[model samples]
Target: MADARSTAAYLCGKLYATLWALGVLGTAAPTPSPLTPGRDESTARFPRDELKRRLAAAGAHMITAKGRGGDRAQAASEVFRSIPDLIPVAGLPQKRYTNQEVLQFSQGCAAQLTTYREKYGSLLH
Candidate 1:
């Protein structure tokens, strides 16, 4: 169970890192709020914060399932299924992306899934 929790944490960390690298996550520095008209809140949460929160919640669920002697693999799979919802469309004018960007994002997702399988294939049973 401890191993399952550790694996889930590790997987989530890697996914977060990949999202950051792809600019799917917000900038390290907080931007000024348009509502504030020039006042920048260093502690302001960005749109990506919701995605992070969801991921953390999913990780917690994975841990909880393992602790309760449920199928950790199924719990982890549920977390994986929720990942697509993390892609933000809040600020977009339209639900359209450039072809190159879409291709790159798809490739990145494939790579991340491959990494996950490599790391947790045995435990996922």
Candidate 2:
């Protein structure tokens, strides 16, 4: 039998492949909703607004926890990994996000927060 890490990796790979096969891992193309003519439901339901809120909250928490020297990127990554439901879009299982993807998304969120702070000052204050 494969070691625990190898088995986990193998399972994760299979899961990703299955998600792709089901067309759940590609670009979120717009699909018009009959009820909301002219509006793409997929885009409408994306969790961007929620994500921003969560990122800001996480940033605030990190700042409070470590003052100015806190690692916001690492904190954001951990928050996202621990709370997958914070992500707005859906279809794939929560475990679908690989560690790399979580890191990338967290880093992106952290960068966006940094830019916002540079322009508008601290979010918490």
RMSD of each predicted structure? 16.4, 16.5
Model 1 stretches astray by more than 4 angstroms: 1-56, 65-95
lDDT digits (tens) for residues 1-125 of candidate 2: 43432233323222222222112111134322111335422212332343344344553444443443334333333333433332324422334345544333434334434443454343222
Evaluate all candidate structures by whole-model CA lDDT and list the values in order.
0.38, 0.33
Candidates in order, TM-scores: namely: 0.34, 0.26
lDDT string, candidate 1, 2-64, tens digits: 332223223333344333222211222432312132441211122234335545565454554
Question: Candidate 2's C-alpha lDDT?
Answer: 0.33
